[model samples]
Target chain A: MYSYSEFDEAFVRERVSQFRAQVERRIDGSLTEDEFKPLRLMNGLYLQLHAYMLRVAIPYGTLAPHQMRQLAMIAERWDKGYGHFTTRQNIQFNWPKLKDVPDILDALADVEMHAIQTSGNTIRNVTADHFAGAAADEIADPRPVAELLRQWSTDHPEFQFLPRKFKIAITGSPNDRAVTKAHDIGLRMVRNEAGEEGFEVIVGGGLGRTPMIGKVIREFLPREDLLPYVEAIVSVWNLLGRRDNKFKARIKITVHEHGIEEIRRLVEDRFTEIRPGFSGVDQEVLAGLEAAFARPSLPERSLGGFESAYTNDPVFRAWSDTNVAEHAVPGYGIVTISLKAHGKTPGDASADQMRLMADLAEELGHSEIRISHEQNVILPHVHKSDLPRVHAALKEAGLGTANVGLASDIIACPGMDYCALATARSIPIAQEIAERVDELKIEHEVGHLKIKISGCINACGHHHVGHIGILGLDRAGVENYQITLGGDGTESASIGERAGPGFSADQIVPAIERLILAYLDLRESDSETFIQSYRRLGPAPFKAALYPETAEKERADAA
Target chain B: MSRKFTPKVVTGNALIEGDAVWLTEDDRWTREMSEAELIEDEAHAQMRLLFGQSQPSVVVGVYLADAKAGLNGPEPTHFREDFRTRGPSNYPHGKQATA
Candidate 1:
């Protein structure tokens, strides 16, 4: 993790003081609500349905344990004793008082984190693969590149007020855990034909009312040219993007309206013009950023305790099987502590749990904690010798739901329950599904599933990419859930197809239950996942499972 | 003839605390939806909403929400408003947390 330089610290402190004065001006009645709205949003404060929500940026999903502890402190002091980790790799404090926001900003500055660029039509947090540095398949850590992008994009004057919000995700590995395909700009580190590492630049991918898989603007951009090339893409979109309609303002729509080839041509033209402005200073910054990320390496360690725990303890073995991912280091493993405990709110970590994780990260892990886009916390570089201890601590803290990629590990956005834009509640629906899945004890058996729920069509929960996507809507004043099938968010990203008529709030859980059970029966073997089964046989079987009543009516009609 | 207007109440989130609040007939912002002034006429609802919006320092994002005459005062018709009456269903932290 990169510690903030004196300059960086000064910049953040200045921003905080400016926001504090702005907040004071608003409270003192000098600034109108309309005037204060943008200022507050610029500081990542939003008046949500039930309360004021403060979104704090977690750059590249990486957190030093001390930073994590500071976050815990903020949650305990000013928030509702908990923080919700969003799908965008940010933490939102839901119950922040307006008067306390400036204090919160000041506190965040203390830890070199800020809420800047979290909202407004600006470049938001730059997220990366949670397992970036530790993943066995990664060629290099993507955080340095992500950090460089973060620095370049933060408060950049020319691009601050673009047509709409922009997001960028980067990953080091070919297997895209960063959901690169679903971002406005996705950068995947790849090796060129010459065996030199470069980036496969993807642009215009987003999910909302309109879901798009980002187009490959640059198939293989040289490592040194990343900053300039990315700048060109955003610059092209800033000028050409539609400002008329909010829905059509995203770069994804721009790409859709203007062909990718034409867009690429414009980007190349812009790259030529602006490439000189960089003057290789970005390279110097990137080199310094890379060195800052050179944390103590995960040296090989004895795995005897780990092996014995795996063999002897069924509980530990189950958790290890579900939550652990292979690390690049010989004896280390990446542990994703599932926040999606069955029947509990997904992605929410209590202040105590956050503190515990911070302490555990310092003690057992390499003092590094990562917040995954899946809403789980990651100890990306934990030695196998420490896995049992880490798991034990997490288990004791009620953070030991061993369902990382399983059916019960669902991603649900804060629907009508908290969001003003939500048409219906999504949390209860997510809760019911997870509870049923756990009650059946077939989550592990049902195997590798991505169940995502969105409160609305905004798809903040990444519902468009789930194998079982549940979209909550309001119909005739009643809550309705529409299911989408066969959506994926990996290297092979595709928008999910809507299954059929929406189910009522009462019927949705049962509908999802039927769908999962059907997948279990339809699958060829345990190895076949829900997505694999769906792709192999198509939506017919899943639709039949989701709408058994309609399927029966159709059968009668055919008969 | 114009269609009869449904009952409505002026609502906004408290500026300082950000709690969901409804305007009472006595010109007070109350967190309790049951204490809200449910306007039967469309003109009264619009006026009440304007008044709510006027209190910029007291509230933010004022609007009229569909309401109905309840045993006490006003009851929300839409689920969104109903959710605001209570807090998020995921946890017991909102008004319903203790209720």
Candidate 2:
């Protein structure tokens, strides 16, 4: 984990102080709502459905144990005893008084965390693969580059107010764990023909009302040219991005309207202008950042009770199969602590749960903790020998679900339940789906399915990328849900196409059950996953399952 | 043909606590929609909205919410307004805890 320098520390302190003054001004009626709105948004405050929500950035989803403890403390004291981890790898406190927010920010600054740039039309937090350094398949850690971008984008005067909120994601692995393709700028660290590490820069990819898979503008941008090149892309976007319409203000929209070729030309031109100004200063900074991310050392140990535990304990075996991933180190394993326990709200962690995770991370694993985009916590380097104990601890804390990539591990945003922008409720729907699947006891049997739900068209839950995507909408003041099939959020990413019409909230869970059951029947083999089966057979069967009567009528009409 | 305007209430979040509050006929903030002043007329609704907006120290994001006259006082017509009156569905926090 990267520690904040004196400059970084001072910067955060200054921002907190500034926000404190702004809050005072707003309270005293010196600043109007218009004046205070952008100020509050810049500091990651939002006037949500029930209260003012504060979104605090966990930079690149990485946090030290001490920092995690501070977050727990904040949740206990300031929030309603819990915090929500968002798909963007940030924690959202749904209820925070406007008066207490400044003090809350002061608390955050103490732990080198702040709400700055987590919202509004600014460069949001730079996210990376949760398994960045620890994944066995990774070429290199993407954190150093992510950290560099974080440092660069923070209070960058030139790009403070873009046409729309911009997001960037980077992944170090060939298999994209981070949803890099669904970002305004996606950086995949790739080794060139000469074995020199570089980024395959993908641009204009976003998910909202309009979804687009990012196009690779630069197949291999040298390590040195990264800062300037990225700056160039954003610069081009800032200039040409639509300002007349808020809906079409994203870089994706700009890329779409102007075409990638024209955008590339503009970016290359801007790159030429900005390249000389950097003059290796960023490279020098990156060298220090790379040095700061020290690899954890693990002593050689015997397999010991691991094999025995796997064989003897069925519960432990089930958990280990789903929750554990292969670590870069031989004896080490990456453990994903499921927040999606059966019938609970997705991404919500109680203060006690947060503290428990913090304690476990410090004691068993390294003091490092990562918040994944999938709304789960990652213990990136836990020893395989310690698996049983860790599993036991998680189970005791109600954190053990053994459903990492299963049908029940659903990703849902705080829709109408807490979000002012939400047209319909997402949390309850997600809970219903998970509980229904768990009740049926077919989650593991279904296997490797992603069910992402968004309350509105914003796609905050990355519903566009879910294999079974459910989008909740308000039709004539009633809740309606539309399902999309065959969406993926990996190296082979595809936007899910909608199955015609929609179901009521009451009808949604059963509809999903029917779809999954239909998938089981249509699949060529048990080994074939839901997405694989859908790809093999196409959306015809799934669409038929969603609306059997319509399909039957259409069949009869055809006959 | 244009649709007729529905019954409404002046609603906003409290400036300090940030909890959802409705503007009452007595010119006060109330957590319950039942206590809210139901403005059936468009002009009266606008006036109440203006009144709510004026008190920057009292409330924020002041706007008219769709509502209806009930046996009690005023009731929310939309699910969103009803949600605001109570709280989030997942947890018994916010207004739901105290109410």
Candidate 3:
């Protein structure tokens, strides 16, 4: 994890003081609602359905044990005893009072965390692969680059007020765990023909009302030229991006209007103008960051406990099988703590739960806790021998869920339950789906499947990439759900195609049950996942499952 | 032909607490939806909305919500207003918790 420097510390403290003054002004009636709204939004405050939601940025999903403890403290003292971890790798406290926000920010700054630039038109939190440092297949940890971008874009003078909000995602590995293809600027670290490490720069990929796969502008960009080149891309988009219609203001629409080739040419031209100004200072900064992010040494440890526990304890074995991933080290494993326990709200952790996780991370997980975009917590480095103890602690807290990528481990936005912008209730739908899957006892048997739900068309839940995507909408005052099949978010990213007619809220869970049953019957083998089966058979059978009467009517007409 | 105006209530969130509040006939911002003055006429609803919006520092996002005359006083017609009257379905917090 990267610790804040003196400058960072002072800058954050200054922002808190400024916000404190602004809050006073608003309370005293000096600032109007319109005036305070943007100011509040810039500091990651938003008026939601029930209360104000404060989104605190967990920079690149990294947290120290003390920071985690402080977050728990804030939840206990200021919020509703719990906080929500979002798909953007940030934590949202849904019930902070306006009067307490400044104090909440002061508390956050005490732990070197702040909500600055988590919202508004400026660059949001720079996200990376949750398995960045620990994944066995990682070429290098993406944190250094992610942190560099964070430092550069925090309050970039030239790009503060862009045409619209911009998002950036980077990954060091070829596996693409960060969903790089769906970001405004996707940076994938790659080794060129000469074996020199560089990046494949992807531009204009986004998911919202309009979803588009990012196009590769530069197949290989030397690591040294990252700052100037990225500036050039954002600069060009800032100029060419639409401002009249907020709907068409993203870089994706800009890229759509002017073809990727033209955009690439413009970026190259802009790069020529701005390249000399960068002057290798970013590389020097990166070297310092790399030193700060150095992984702790893990000497060899015995796996006798791990082996015995796996063999003797069925519950431990089940959790290890589902929630654990291979770490870069030989005697270590990456543990994903599932926030989606059966029938509970996804991504919500109580203050006690947070404190327990903090202790667990410090004692057993190298004091490092990572929040993943999939709404789960990751202990990046845990010894295999300590697996049983970790599992025991998690189980005691009702946090030891054996589903990570299973069907029951769904990613859902706050939806109508908490979000003011949501069209329908996403949380209840997700809860019902998880309960149904649990009741059927088919999650482990069903194997790895992603079911992402979004309350609105904002795509905050990454519903477009779900293996079984459920988009909740308000069709003429009633809650309606539309299902999509075969969407993927990986090295091979593709948007999901919509199935036939939407289902009512009452009929949705059963409809999903029918789809899964049909998938089980249609799959060629157990090894074939849901996405594979859908691709092999196409949407015909799944459509039939979703709308049996329509499929029957069509069959009869064809016959 | 244009549809007739439905019964409505002036609603907003308290600026300090950020909880749901409804405008009453006596110019009070009450937390309970049942305490709100249900306006059947469009003109009266607009007047109530103006009254809600006037308290800029005390409230935020003042608007009219569809309602119906109930035995309690006023009932929310939309599920959203119903949610606001109580709280989120998942957690027993907000008005529901206290009530």
Candidate 4:
């Protein structure tokens, strides 16, 4: 994990002091709500449906045990004894008094953390692969680059107030766990023809009212030119991108309106103008950041004990099967702690649980923990020998869920329950659906299904990329949900198609059950997963299952 | 109607571990106070000053009220007594309590 340099520490401390004064001003009535809203948003504070929420950024999802413990302390002290981990790999305290937020930021700064850029139109936290440094197939670790970007983008004077919020994601490997292709700017490390590592830069991809898969503006950008090129792309967008309509303000909408070729031409022109300014200073800075991310040395050990433990313990075997993944190191494995326990609220961890995770991270695994964009925690460098003990500890702490990529692991936004913008309840609906799927005992058979729920068109839950997407809406003062099928979140990402009609909150669970059973019945064989069947057969069969009456009417017309 | 309001202590979720409270009488805080006293009527006045005016009235008690109802309705105050009475703060009251 990367430790904060003295400069970084001083910068955050200054920012905290600045915000404390701003809070005091707001309370004194010198700054009105209109004047105070933007300042609070810049610091990741929001007045939601019920209470104030303070979102703290876990930069690139990386955390030291002490940082994790600090988060637990915050929850215990200022919140409702728990924190909700968000899909963006950040944690949100759903309850905090306006007066105490400054104190919270101060406490976070003590641990070298802050909520800066976690919200607002500035470049939000730069996300990367959860298994970045540890993935066996990785060409290089992406976190060093992510950390470098974090340093450069933090309160960049020019880009602080973009037309809309910007997101950037990087991946070290081609497997694309970070969903790089679906971000404002996606950087994937790749090798050129000369066998030198560089980046394949993609721009304009995002999910919102308008969902777009990013277009590749540069096939391969040399590593040294990363910052200059990014500056060129953002500058081009800032000057030329539409500011007329809020809905059409994102770079994706600009790319859609002007066409990718034109956008590419503009970016190329901008890049040429700025390429001369690229100095060796960026390379030296990146080198320093890379040194900070030096991998932990593995102890000399054999995996014979791990093999025996897995064979003897069924629970450990199940966890190892689902949660453990191949590590870059021979004797180590990356362990994912699934927050989606069946029938419970997804992505919520009690203060006690957070403390327990911190202790376990220090004791059984490496002293580093990672939060995934999927809202799970990763003990990125656990030895194979420690798997059984870790699994036992996790089970006791209610964090040992054996569903990592499975169906019950749903990603939902803070819907009507918390978000004022939300039309219906997203979290409880996701909870109910997971509970139903568990009761049916068909999640294993369903196999790697992603069911995402968004409470509104804002699409914070990323419903557009789920195998089965549930969109909650308000209809005649009642909560209604719409279902979509065949959405994917991978190298081959696609927007899902909506099925027939929307169902009321009470009717949505059975509707989803019907859709799943229909897939089961129409599947070529049990070997085929829901996504495969949906893709191969298209929405016709799923639509038929959802609205048999419509299908019958169509058949009768054809007859 | 003019009614005398008693002094009480207001408590909320603590910063570190124990509890946070403010005393209504002195407009100061003492670490020592029972949870029961923290739920009294005058305790709420302190809560309003600390948390904000829009905080939900979870527990309320009064020495005087509408004579027809005999302490049934809430005690009269300078602010409106209607169910939909607005809070004093420019920002909505109780917005910070949820966080």
Candidate 5:
């Protein structure tokens, strides 16, 4: 992890002080509600349905043990002893009072973290692959570039108030774990013909009401040109994006109205205008940034215990199979502690769990933790020898659920439960579905399925990219859930297609069950995942399963 | 012929606690929706909303939401408003925890 420079420390401290004063002014009536809202939002504070929610950015989803402890302390002291990790690799404290929020911000600054640009139309927290530095298949650690982008975009006056909130994700690995194709701007690190690593820049991708896979505007951009080039893209959008209707304001909409070719031309023109101003200073910063992220070579450790545990314990074997991934370093593994334990709220970690993770990270793993966009915590560089012990600790803390990419690993937004913008409840639906799936005992058999549920069309849960997506809607004051199938959020990104009429909340879980059960029969083999089978067989079979009665009625009517 | 207007209540989140609160007929905020003052008339509902909005220090995002006068008090007509009354459903947190 990069230590904060004196300049960075001073900058964050100043922001905390400024926000403290702003809160005081708002309380004293010097600032009206209208005036205060944006100020609070800019500081990552939102007046949610039930309370003031403060979103704290975990830059590129990386956290030091000390930072994790601070987060736990904040959760215990100011919040409800829990924090909800969101899809954007951010943690949201749901019950921070307005007066206490400043203190929270100051505490965050103590650990070189701040909520700046976590909200508002500014370039939000620049997320990267959670397995960035540790992934076995990574071409290069993308966090240095992500960090460079974060430093460049933080309080950037020129792009602060865009037409709508902008999100950018970068993935160094070819596997695309960061869901790059679903962000406003997606940067996939790639090598050119010359064999120098650069970026394949994709723009116009978003997952709100209008879900889109970003189009590749640039085939390969030199690593040095990233900042200025991205600046140009946003600048083009800043000028052309609609400000009239909030719904039509995102850069994705602008890119949709104008073809990607035209947008690329405009961005290129803008890039040329600003290219001279950079003059290679960014390269200097990136060099320093890269050095900060360089991991010391780890001595190979014995994996005797790891092998013994995997063979000896069925529980450990199941967990290792699902929760652990290959690490770049030999004898090391990347562990994803499932936050989606059956019947628990997805993405939520208790304060005690946070402290436990911190302790484990310090003792066993490197003093590092990561929040995955899938709403799970990742100890990105854990030694394989320590796997059983870590698993035991996690089991004790109610964090061990051997269902990482399986059916129970669902992504659900804080729908009507806590989100003021939500039209219906999403959490309970997610909980019910997970419980149902666990009861059926087919989670492992389902194999590599991503079920995502969103409370509304806002698509906060990234429902558009799920293998099986569920969208909660308010139909004449009743909760209705619509299903979409074959949506994927990987290298082969595709938006799921809706399967006919929506089901009532009561009918949703059963509908999903029907779909999954149908996939089992439809798939060529057990190895063929739900997504592969869906692509091969199309949505017809799944749709038929979801609406069996309706299909039968239609067939009978036709007859 | 004019369509009959559904009942409504002036609702907003508390300024400090941020919990959902509804306006009473006597110009007070109550966390319980059951104690909320139900206004059948659109003009009265607008007036109540204005009154709720005026207290910027007390509440935020004041608006009129569809409701019906139950046997005890004002009941939410929409599922969203109902959720606002009873915190998140995933766990016993927020208002549900306290209530």
Candidate 6:
């Protein structure tokens, strides 16, 4: 994990003090709600239905055990003894009072964590592959670059007030676990013909009302030019991106309206103008940041023991089959801590669980944890020797869910529950669906499914990219959920197609069950996943299953 | 019937557990008493005294329906019983008390 330097410490301390003063002024009536709202939002504090919600950034989803423990303390001391981990890989406390937020922030600063860019239109939390350093297929670890981008974009004067929130994601591997393609800027580390590591830059990807996959603006951007190139792209978007309508304010809409070619041209032009200005100082700064991210030394161990352990322990084998990933280093595995328990809220982690993860990280794995863009926690560099102990601790804490990349591990936003803009309750829906799927134990049979739920059209849940996406909407004051199928969140990312008319909140789970059964029937072979079958048969069969009566009615009407 | 609004309190584990209260007349935090009790309560004096130091602290009471009514409603749901019970339609609110 990247430890904070003196400068980083000073910056957070200063921010906390500043926010404390602001809170005092707001309470004294010196600042109006209108004036204080932006300030509070900048600090990741949101006024929700009953109380205030504070979202803390776990930058690029990385956390130290100490930081995780600090978070647990915050939840225990100031929140509901539980924290909601969000789709962005951030943790949110739903009940912090206005007076207590500054204190909470100070506590976070003590652990080298702060909520500076967690909210606001300014570049939000920089997300990356949860399995970054450990993934066997990684070309290069993306964290160093993510860290560099975080520092550069944090309070950057030019990007302080963009038309809308900007999100950036990076991936070290071709597998795309980070959902990089659905962000404003997606950077995938790639190797050139000369074997020089660089980035394959994709731009304009987003998933609000108008979902889009990023277009490749640059095929191969040299590592040195990363920051300048990013600056150029953002500057171009800021200059030309729509501001007249909030709906069309994102860079994705800008790319759509102007076309990728024009946007690429503009970015290239801007890049040419800015590249000269980035002096050797930038390179020095990046190198300094890179040094901070140097991988922790691993003690060599035998793989023979790990193989034997897996064979001997069925539980361990089951866990390894689903939750563990191949590591770049021998005898090491990337372990994911699934937050999606059967009937529990999708990403809600109790205070005790947080502390347990922190303790486990420090004891068994490296004292580091990474939050996945999928809303799960990761112990990126766990040794095979520590697997059983880690799994045992995780199981005790209710974090040992062996359903990674399966149907039960659904990504959801805190829809109608906490968000002022949600149409229906997303977390509960996600919970119900996950629980239902778990009961069926057909997740493996369903295969690699990505189910996402957004409360509304904003698509914060990335519902648009789910293999089976559910968008919760309000229909005539009733909670209604609209289902979409054939969506994917991988290298070949595609937006889902709406199956039929929406289902009532109660009808949604049963409707999903029907859809899954339909997939099984339509599948060419047992090996064919939901996405594969859906792709092969197209949306017609699924649509027919979803609205058999409607289809029949339409046919009769046509006849 | 109009939309049902859900009443909620803002207190979390950060505050004293029982301090959670429903918003009453003039932004006062009142215990979850009935409408009749709310009308006749003398505790308002003490609450006013306590909350006076905090500006913009008045917790205005509205019907549940008023509070749950969303963006496109006749008026934004504010302290409406109907709205409180039903929750906001377009966005997530009212499903959980904290939200």
Single out the weakest 10-residue window by summed lDDT for candidate 3 chain A: A291-300
lDDT of 1 by residue, B1-99 (tens): 999899989999899989999999999999899998989998888788888888898899999888999898899988788888989888888788756
Once fitted onto the true fold, the runs of candidate 3 whose alpha carbons sit more than 4 angstroms away are: none
Evaluation by DockQ, superior candidate among 1 and 5: 1
Measured against the true structure, the TM-scores of the candidates, in listed sequence, are 0.99, 0.99, 0.99, 0.85, 0.98, 0.88
Per-residue lDDT tens digits for candidate 2, residues A1-559, read: 7888999999999999999999999999999888999999999999988889999998899988888889889988988888999999999998889989999999999989999999988999999999988999999999999999999999999889899999999999999989999999999999999999999999999999999999989999999999999999999999898888999999988989999899999999999998999889889989998888876887778778677898999999999999999999999899999999999999999999999999999998988789999999999989898889889999999998999999989999999999999999999999999999989999888888999999999999889999999999999989999998889999999999998898999999999999999998888888999999999999998989989899999999999
On DockQ, the leading prediction is 1
Residue-level lDDT tens digits of model 4 in A276-351: 8867887898998888887888786878879998999887897898899999888899999999998767788888
lDDT of 3 at B40: 92
User: lDDT score of model 1?
Assistant: 0.91
lDDT (10s digit) by residue, model 4, range B31-87: 333211322355555454444322222211111111111133222221111111221
Question: What's the residue-level lDDT of A199 in candidate 6?
Answer: 96
Off by over 4 Å in 5: A557-559
Residues A1-559 of candidate 3 have per-residue lDDT tens digits of: 7888999999999999999999999999999899999999999999988899999999889999999899999999999899999999999999999999999999999999999999899899999999989999988899999999999998899989999999999999999999999999999999998999989999999888998899999999999999899999999999998999999999999999999999999999999999999978899999999988888888899999999999999999999999999999998999999999999999999999999999999999989899999999999999999999999999999999999999989999999998999989999999999999999999888898999999989989888999999999989888899998888888989899999788999999999999999999999999999999999999999989989999899999999
lDDT of residue A455 for candidate 3: 91
Q: Assess each prediction's global lDDT (C-alpha) against the native.
A: 0.91, 0.92, 0.93, 0.79, 0.92, 0.80
Which stretches of model 2 miss by more than 4 angstroms? B1-3
User: Candidate 2, residue A447: CA error in Å?
Assistant: 0.7
Per-residue C-alpha lDDT of model 6 across residues A1-559, encoded as one tens digit per residue: 5778898999999999999999888777777666777998899987654457899998888888888989999999988788888888899987777788999999999988989988878899999988877789988788889998998998899999998899999999999988888999999999999999899999999888888889999999999999999999999999887888888889999999899999989999899999999886777877886777777888898667677878898877888889988888888888989999886777888899999999888987778788887888888888898888888889888888889888889899878666756777888788788889888888877777788999899898989899899999988778889998888878989989887789998899988888888888888888888889888888888887887888799889999
Better of 2 and 3 by DockQ: 2
Q: In model 4, which runs have C-alpha deviations exceeding 4 angstroms? A: A557-559, B1-99
Reported per model, the fraction of native interface contacts reproduced equals 0.81, 0.84, 0.72, 0.02, 0.88, 0.04
Q: Among all windows of ten consecutive residues in candidate 1 chain A, which has the lowest summed lDDT?
A: A293-302
For A295-407, candidate 1 gives per-residue lDDT tens digits of 57767778999999999999999999999999887888899999999999999999899999999989988788999999999998889988999989999999988999999
**For residues A154-271, could you state the per-residue lDDT of candidate 5 as single tens digits?**
8898998899999999999999999999899999999999999999999999898999999999999999899999999999999999999899999888999999999999999999
